[model samples]
Target: MTAIPSAELHTPDELLANASAMYASGDPKLFRGAILESITALEAFVQRTVFRSLEGRLDPLLVKWLEEKTRMDFDSRLSVLTQVATGLPINKSSELWDGYKKAKEIRNKVVHSGRKVTAMDVELVMASVRDWLSYLGTTVELEAVLLTLKRWVEQSPKPPIENEAQAIQLVAQYFHQSAAARITIEAEINTGGRRHRADMILDFGPRKVLVETKFPRLANNVRNVIRDAVEQADAKRQAANIGQACVIAFLRKRPEGVSDVVERHKGGGILSIAIETH
Candidate 1:
């Protein structure tokens, strides 16, 4: 497969520049054209970056369906596909998303029906698109999260978390105190029709993840405990658009036994971390 030439990839900035130029020309007739360029910018970002990111992350068939067969609107790409492939959670109800959705509607009215858009309409689309792009730098990166956790667990004194609850609280506090990013953690998030509570729900700006904690002191099958936590997290994750993770804190010490369960699920997007006792 021939790679897409880098020069051919249109960034949001470049397209926005063109859109802004049109918007500033003082022509209502060109307002729709400007909005059209903005929509193209969104598509370019998704097609160029998102599809490539999913090469090995998702199954080939699903990836094909998502990229080719599915006629995903902007909302679907932002709210669903991007999250599935990249773990970048997007809350559709956020003010940024709400604004982009309005911009999309305005663009649709202009493009799909050939209707005239006002000066305010063009400004709304430009502002909304820029707002969504501003968070790209801060979106959740799974490796970064795991790296942060690794550092937290390896601290000199170690986190003195005794049970699952303490682990959750301490983990939440750790994220809150983090200098790089102050993640918002909510406790006992009800997912799957509120049938169960996810131990800790973290908001990483444009991303969200539900965490399940396990503190097994005497359990013989530690692998099974971790696997069960992964399954629980996966279920909760599937119920919503958020990502999932399992944080297992050892009350005694880290179990040195596991048959690739940790490695396998980490690849599956349910990050399982063990806080070893030092």
Candidate 2:
């Protein structure tokens, strides 16, 4: 297959368009590879734009511009980009930083390792591409606005107030939005037995669900975590009149022991949920 010509005058929107086209081409392998390439290109563009914009004085107009153009909360949005773009050793941030790390890993396997890229992989890569493009568009637009603001600040006679409120508000909103159910972590059990802190607790009305997260990379660890969670849940239930209680062994990746574990625990209330995070 002939390679598509590299996009010239690279822009976030253009990169996104190319990705969409590649995804629509009906070939899973090609689509996945193209999406990865598009992400790489988009990240490079954002880094360049951000560095160039930062050369001049910071100004409030930049914040206004971001709000007006992207409809994102000014402080929160800028902080996210800055953290990923600056203070990081990599010129291009990690794929995980942009939430595409998992997609990139799958793409690498499909493209270089002769692994078959599934339709689900293509769909996921396409979604990641879209998110990358959206982030790029917002960042690029902010850079342009920042440049304008810098010029205005340099020439203006009056000094502007330092708007740290935007930064504070941004952090607060981020924590609020990403907030998860609080699960206590400890090293001992109430029964004077040694135990690991609860990894996660899911409250379901009359039933309480407990989960221990484990990486599939370690088979024994995964089994142990699941077993421990189940045992803990069982113990907790024995002391109280709880309804529909179960311990979940959660794996972020598929493990080889999954089948054996499931078979052994068949008809038991123990469950497993496969999750992947980027």
Candidate 3:
């Protein structure tokens, strides 16, 4: 038989250009794995460039760029970047960082060990990577990725929690009953001069307690609500003959490290109760 010559593959840069073209043409999945591989390659390139430029003396320009990009003080940028290299999102970024990390692990497994990559896996990794890229203003092939991610999310086996408002109401009821001695329960206090309903209030005979009930998932939002409630409570207390006043957050579940937070602000008469439900 006559010998046939096999064509040589393109260079990394050429492959990257081809991938970019495919992405631009709306064929994102055509070279999804290759694009991710390119990102890995680019990361290595950035690291090598940094190391080569920094030989012994650090470049002030590079230092300034790093500081500006991260919005961090000079001393913390290097440490923060080291953590970021391990796939921590920049700026303590998103609640989905854990999900992104899990997706990245799957990607690494597939790429390095030739493991089977499922559609779901690819979808998750693409979504997270695209989000991170968009946040950083980096170019990403999003259309196809988003489509795949949507499908994956739609096909996800978990059932969505329902009646979040009802759940919060239940938690508020629990807290009200539990603290009946020191706290007086009042529902739907119209405040904010707009008939805004306060979920529950704990009435201290002399000093009033404003309780804003929220789901455990909205723990961060509770902080601002608590702050506003504190100010409002103080205003109400001042307008009356109350001795001390504060706001308490009654959550469906305790947030991590929240007990310490409660203790820290307990001196200020503010309380946060993380309600445990059966």
Candidate 4:
């Protein structure tokens, strides 16, 4: 996934790096930015993750509701999201969540109480934030990644990809670079003693997702493309150790936003999504 290293803003990876640099510099003044960026980056990532991973799956009313909650408390966001979003909520009483809340308080003190932070504060916050990332990556992050790619067609930097290969390239690049996840393109899988190639594979630590992409200009093509990908996924699912696999379809807008996101499922438990791009 892309780490977002460009100059405009810092991604969590960049913010964490800045925190480390500031701590290494031994400049007490810089520690505050480090501390602030560290916490802010975590907050930013949570919102970004939620939107990119789950927005397309939501009803329009829920989309508006989430927009209104842009400034909602993080815990409240998590609480409400658990009601609507997939994946089990991180336990509030667990050490991981509790430690993160404690770290968040330190961040709040810096902003509201004008508290001066030292290197030790930076260390504590950094460790806790890193732990949070690790926990998410190893646990429920697979669901998050799969959910994100279910709307893979929406992530296209350029709309109207010309063919299946181009569509695969676009989403694969987006996930491999932006999601901070590992991916393999044109990966080979064996089924029924014969070998076939799947569009892509995504890795979230121990878990994985088999991805097949489709670009359908006509509405009728939607079902056919989805069926084709499901067959492919079913073939590779057993061979690849993937419990879940998905097909992402980018539909051209001749009718111009004629449809929102349409999802389909096969008996083999494969999911397919069609997102219109205008």
Candidate 5:
């Protein structure tokens, strides 16, 4: 896990962070914080991606007019941003307009009519904004790191890796200097059996992620490695009092039913990402 520094958090990230904090407090009224923040996050994403990209495309006078005369209201901004993004080659079209419309409508009701939004309202808004934000190149820091890792794995050589150590090294090559500083290799912890060694441990201040690497050639071999890695990750996580962990399986062939396993463990704070080399 890569820790995102507070300084590097974009507007959407910061809003989501606040929303998460409020949600975790178990106060129902505070759910509004999540809704409001989600709206702001969507607006900020539009400014960052759509508005910023138009820096040189529009006439200077027109740009200045927009800056000075535009309503800066949520709906107005969203409309302009969507229009511009849809027309620009640099921007990707989104399928999130329906969700965006719903979110904005709910925001209007809540703010204009003093309405109370349920947990579902907040969840819906967040889910909708997430896609738009992602398309606009805005995401939480950890998500950004994970995306980079996925891209690295996809771009890596197709030949199977030699061993666990080589696979670990390959993953490490993608880490930034700051991330590299927080990594611990072969970290030892007491787990009833003298010393239980974790292949890698990433310390992200509040979140610790245990990573296990494996190179599997056969179907049975993949299962065995996954079992061992999950056990190792669990032991390390329990010892460290951390809840997040993942197993990276560098595979010659993806085993049948492995995707189901990955989906099952997703909500349980464990991830199984199979990186195919063949």
Candidate 6:
């Protein structure tokens, strides 16, 4: 998947970029992925707005319940978000509401029944997604919510890593907290002939970064390890439609000859960084 540089994009734009890429891919799974991201963008937006509106006064248990409820299946979640946000009942009279409902049906068809989705279906969903985004943006409170998220990203802490698992955890947490990138831990990606579990994935709209954390053993072949890491990163990138990869080697002790920060491997296919755990 081709991606525009996302170094300057806000969270929502990143999500939209992913949606656009998926819609353009001409693959059913890609289309489905696009639809899911589109909906997820709205869900996150709405949830943040709702939470902001409540002003940290909602009961802890109630807040948790609301969060879970907001995460219900697409249709239910959308309906709840619309109703809570607008205070207007979603009836047949509202074209935007109806359009979202239709989009939900299309998503279900592709996801549930293994039905082939058409380009038109993707177009319709995109339209609905845009409509929802626009609607949310028009409101002052929701717009403030969006700005808050962007600011929070600007103020986020750098990820701390001391071990292999912590490296993956901290990297994932860093992207998500700092840039509104969606983070997935231990996600399995198909590597052509087989599947491997990626330590983490940082999804930023059209572009994704696959991350791997390795704590190599004392007797492991260093050359072979580096070669395998580069190849694995490349394979996972292709499988996940990701454009970039980061492989972190948490060694028990710093190797004598290796560079601490070798930025890219195989001509930028991977970003290989090594850290000493001593």
What's the lDDT for all of these models? 0.61, 0.43, 0.40, 0.63, 0.60, 0.61
Report lDDT (Cα) of residue 150, candidate 3: 25
Put down candidate 3 lDDT per residue, 1-278, tens digits, no spaces: 11211111112333245435544455435445644654453344334332222321246587556645755332243235533322223444454555556665786676688776555565565555444433321101111111222223234443332444664444344344332224443444434453444444544332334444434457656556556666665554444434333333445444565542221132333333333322
Shift in Å, residue 236, candidate 2: 54
Which candidate leads in lDDT? 4
For model 4, residues 159-204, the per-residue Cα lDDT tens digits are 4567778777767665755444567888888877898888887765
Which of the predicted structures, 2 or 3, would earn the higher TM-score when compared with the native? Answer: 2
For candidate 6, lDDT tens digit of each residue in 94-148? 8998888888888778879988867788888888877776554333232233234
Instruction: Specify the poorest-scoring 10-residue window by lDDT in model 4.
Output: 1-10
How many backbone clashes can be found in candidate 6? 1
Model 2, position 13, has a per-residue lDDT of 41
lDDT for each residue of candidate 1 in 1-278, tens digit (9 for 90 to 100):
12111112122355478898888898877888888887787667666556544544567687778887546565677777766655655787788778988988898788689777888888888888876654432222333344345444655454455676776765665555433343445445456457667766655454465667677776466767877878877877777667445554454565567431123264446666555645
**Cα TM-score per model:** 0.46, 0.34, 0.27, 0.62, 0.49, 0.43
The alpha-carbon lDDT assigned to residue 178 of candidate 3 equals 30
Q: Report the C-alpha lDDT of model 2 over 149-237, residue by residue, as the tens digit.
A: 32333344443223323322321232222122222332223443544344434332323434333433454576666666566665653
- In terms of lDDT, model 1 sits at 0.61
RMSD after CA superposition, every candidate: 11.6, 21.5, 23.2, 6.5, 13.0, 17.2
Q: For model 2, what is the error of residue 8's alpha carbon versus the real structure, in angstroms, after optimal superposition?
A: 13
